[model samples]
Target: MVQPAQSPEPDRSPGPARSSEPARPSDVPADHVVVLFGATGDLARRKLLPGLFHLARAGLMPRRYRIVGSAPAAEALTDQEFRTHAQQAVAEFGRSRPEGPAWEAFAAGLSFGAADTGAAEPLMAAVREAETALGGTPRRLFHLAVPPVAFTSVIDLLGATGLAADGKVIVEKPFGTDLASARALNAAIHAVFDEARVFRIDHFLGKEAVDNVLALRFANGLFEPLWNRDHISHVQIDVPEHIDIQGRARFFEGTGTFRDMVVTHLFQLLGFIAMEPPVALEAGPLRDEQVKVFHSMRALDPAHVVRGQYGGYRDEQGVDPASDTETFVALRVAIDNWRWSGVPFQLRTGKALAEGRHMVTLGLREPVLRMFPLETRAAAEGRSNELVIDFDDPGSITARFLVKEPGPSMRLADGDMLFNYRTAFSAQNFLEGYEHLLLEAMRGNQSLFTRSDGVERLWEVAAPLLDAPPAVRPYAPGSWGPDGIDGLVAPYRWHLPDRRDATP
Candidate 1:
């Protein structure tokens, strides 16, 4: 087993002064039934149900576990109808096809119900019947795969139906548009389920390599000693996607790149990179460390931030013709703590970029001139070493180091020591981020989930940009973000990962 960091005790102070139950163990809950709200929705069809099927196929799901899809507008689907829907989802979007034995086995646990978000009694009756059929007081898990606007109503319904008793809830991201709403949502959720029972899901946190960051830094001795500001010059967390907002105009309109990506995904990455060692790797201790890192971060400076919108974003359906909503954002934030005092952590994310690059690069300070001879000194000036942790589809880790050219004459070349997931673990198949996250939720592990305090801190750091928005620069599709973004990294440019090189 990997050992926990020998760090100081985690802060025991309450999060956001909200009422919460004692923390639970990071183990799978027993005899549970997961009720998925908005079950016929796009997310359920594309990711959640397929993830559950994958879990069942791998024998990772609990023996008595059941999945009941519910939607207010959905007609009461027969078990056959629900199983058919699940079959199509897995066949189309799953990691693998739904084979006979595994498909039938997984489909055996499928059921469906109709429950209005505003009225939960019908759902409550259905769940009671499910538990009775399961032959015990099975733990209830409600996954709200619905929109942010429906969150409170669902929570209220869960409570009214008595489904919140000994139940856990999984909430999707964009917890709220801003800090106040986030706090409000937390309060409402807390009223229904305790903090320990709430799982704030951010699928990126469940990625294999994304989780590997903690392992790479903590488990290995080679990187930990050099992880701080003294040895590292800067950190770059870049997440630029190749696709545009053609279909998601309404979502992109309200939630720009900042709220959509930075507040949740990139900030979590920053936490993993900058947090102090945790007392333990349990949910509370780990999240406490992340919350501290967030608290240590200085408010994002506007001057260090740049925003951009794709050229034809305004012409997209449902978007305002005069929309200034940013589809891309690049900003430099400083962690105001001992380990990363002077380091500038540049975070950039956008839509319709050159490639779907998702990686974090730690640029180490250049070595001293005394290490190299006079002849090769010039070539080694700006050739700083960098450690990159990629969160692409299959994931990878790479170290860029300077090496002497084969032909001698003190000539130098940059060589990479790469570790691709496929190259290292060829026998296993890669799971989607949501698949891993959903499995973890079923297993009652909150370590990969976002915490309420962490969300609040993210909003705090992003308050300036949220309050007085920056001018959204217009950039053509298939280009790196606005030209000003290039200046943020100055001597170094963003590392663009080719889609061809990305793992499927």
Candidate 2:
């Protein structure tokens, strides 16, 4: 089996006491049933089941809850058989093994049902059984862990069977192939569920480090004043994965790096970085601000974009030998707004690269006046000031600046001020992306969920490139990307992945 990449474990050592309180009684979700579609799939075994187990262990789940797992008839397992499979999945993929009272209790709540395409009766029967066991008409949360192609069928099943009535639904990424498909999908979803009842999952936004961007910018006096074009030269959101497609050749062939990473993940991160402060931190205001950022974004220019395919990709199983699909992409995105007009936001993502990094870096402009001699200035200029937010597990924030060397003759050396999450917070308190997002959805907080308008706007922003994509260049595995990418961000270089500084 091809497992997903594992992030570093957080430090377990105790730190300062947590400043936040437990969720209020009202904030806790009421008794609910989570109907997990595609329950026998890889995502369910790898993330959804494990996430639910962790949430139960953390006491974040509702007191009365049940998980009704559904899959195609051919893949369905008996309830006891499904429980055994779930135990194995949790043992292998969960942060903690399933071996105690908590595991037993969680496993007892899991059951499986079978449903074929255009058929919702079996799944609805399973839901009814779960509700009967839970005693009341519990609220439902439908988690679509299926592939993008299966989204419409499952959604149509729900609407036809009255399963979507007053229930919230969570759908995964690659929402649509392009602008037209995105609009059509949005219309289909809106037909079944209202905007408020839809939760479009973008796992990147659930990371603590990503959410902290707002706190770091708005809550602090030092960063916000210099957050605009006047003080920042450029912004970089770089995500490079060392691992290739694993066994997902068919999926990768249909959806290249642009749709998989850029439209879904990077654009969301950009909204978080480039958006003006919302009136409040609530869901409506936050999403409004994000949509506004999308509104100001200039459509992607094909000339400023670079697409690349890793060598040997076409040899993978289920891949087309003549595939022109790009596994790597780099683009110079422009946000034609007041704050970020002059500053370029360079976004890049790739699979099978030299290293894997999830980071957002802001390059600070040089000082207005040069006080030092011109000869010595070159050395100082090379080490430009940078503010970086590393979103890998055990996240951190680092600010790089030039420090005066301790010598008779003045010289500058690179220095960094860093705040690491693992050292400052308890490891037990840390939540993985899926776990965090699952809990948030149950609590009815849509702050991290993508709205319909935002989705449409993102498609609009990417229209130019999708209409006429640049040719895909070939790059060797374990390399950064194509040679053509060098000119995409001229003068400014991409931030190479560095774990040494983030190490606790």
Best by lDDT: 2
Estimated TM-score for each candidate: 0.90, 0.93
lDDT of 1 at 115: 78
lDDT of each: 0.79, 0.85
Cα shift from native, residue 244, model 2 (Å): 0.8
lDDT (C-alpha) at residue 302 in model 1: 84
Candidate 2: regions farther than 4 A off: 1-27, 373-383
- For candidate 1, the lDDT comes to 0.79
* Candidate 1, poorest ten consecutive residues by summed lDDT: 1-10
TM-score of candidate 2 relative to the true fold: 0.93
